[model samples]
Target: MEKIERGKALKTGRDYEDIKFRRKVFMSKCVKKAMSLFRIVTLIGISYIVLSPMISIISRAFFSESDVYNAMVYLIPQNGTLKNFKLAILRMDYWKTLGYSLLYIGSLAILQLFICSMVGYGFARFQFPFKKLLFGCVILTIVIPSYTIMLPLYMHFRNFDPLHLFGLLGIGAKNWLTTVKPVY
Candidate 1:
């Protein structure tokens, strides 16, 4: 009778272990499924945010005048045409404008890249008097809206002056707006 009771006890212990194993497997599967769903949702949201504007712009570019007026036209234009591209190229004088832009803006951009790198290196490596104040000014310039300073900057450019030195030197204010000197 004791041997039979010991056999029954071992059988119940094995059943308990089997139940625990099944529960662990079920929980892991649930966790994995939840994580996958979260990832899918996040990807869809990011796709919509990034693609919506680009899709709208492409659709609008292809849209006809009648398509713009039609309320039902959305996402896809009913009458697509390359007329807009031709008009834009002709009106803007594409080649000449592109050449001028590449010459001026491209040079400035390269120069700016070098200047900024040197300035950043200086700021990162050196400690100077008024360093914090100068850094603060740089931050302020970045944070402040360009439009707020636009009028004053425009006026200053129209009559270039540096710390009243030009005035003291008896040199007349030079108009920088007419020249590419402002790029410097």
Candidate 2:
């Protein structure tokens, strides 16, 4: 080995290979650490964004009315009370409201599930005309923005006269806006 030392003891063969190996190892470790730190920060930021609203709502529920007017009150209320909770439950008749809501939502969910399952079964068991096209449409609906169809749907329901049956009875296209008939 020729001893040439301007700064580092520049090595040849095995020593130089070892230095290269060490550099590669260090670089890999640094990259791994950077990636992990990035992932942790990303997760934390997303979690905060998703959870902060729920946290704020729950925190506010625990707060007294005085806390709302107080500028100093923040995440934790200075004087907390269950009055808000009690008043809401009492005024709304919480149990009855919850029961009705759950019944309505559950029935809708079950009906939707049943209809989807029947459609799926029909698709799987039968080979009908334009089957592929229909399936493509079904799949496409998942990707399509709902708002794209909303205007057409709104217009259809807005001027719904169903075979001119209502028109025969001297009634014109009925505006079914905000009516429960459209829900069905």
Candidate 3:
């Protein structure tokens, strides 16, 4: 039935094909336009949601310290300035912290994805003793909160001192940031 209409369309004077193609182009254009709008709206919404608080904070930071303190009691300040930025930079070292956070998060994501894919492939393809148990353990680890191990991890790292290894690598495990020597 569809084929017959297409056949008749082909026979007709460019009406069916032209109309069909135009309709397709129109639909495609509409879809693309809608998608573009959606992307823009989504981006704007996300930016507004994320940046509004930061903007408010930044504005407040520009006010006189006394003014800022007073404003905090009521509504936030509208003023903005370099003093707050300078003070913030001196105190927090924003760039360094941001870099560390990015590196940590990026490494964790890559490691998790790689390990999951490899382990999933192994579980899907291979048979081993207590395989289900091992998989369950992996799943459990994923679900369990990492905050639970904070103190244990802190203690482990604190206690972990490599006598010769530190000298060889020119790195003390205590401070990774100050090390000029690469870890071996």
Report every candidate's CA lDDT.
0.88, 0.91, 0.76
Model 3's TM-score against the true structure: 0.41
Model 1, position 149, has a per-residue lDDT of 89
Q: How well does each candidate superpose onto the true structure, as a TM-score?
A: 0.57, 0.76, 0.41
Alpha-carbon runs more than 4 Å astray in model 1? 1-10, 102-184
lDDT of 1: 0.88
Provide the lowest-lDDT 10-residue window in model 2: 1-10
lDDT (C-alpha) at residue 59 in model 1: 85
Cα-based RMSD of the predictions, in order?
Answer: 7.7, 3.7, 13.1
lDDT score, candidate 2, position 10: 51
Better of 1 and 2 by lDDT: 2
Clashing pairs in 2: none
Q: How far is 108's C-alpha from truth in model 3 (Å)?
A: 4.2
Locate the minimum summed-lDDT window of 10 residues in model 3: 175-184
Q: For candidate 2, write residues 1-184 as lDDT tens digits.
A: 4544678765567878877888999999999999999999999999999999999999999998899999999899999999998999999999999999999999999999999999999999999999999999999999999999999988778878889988999988788876888667
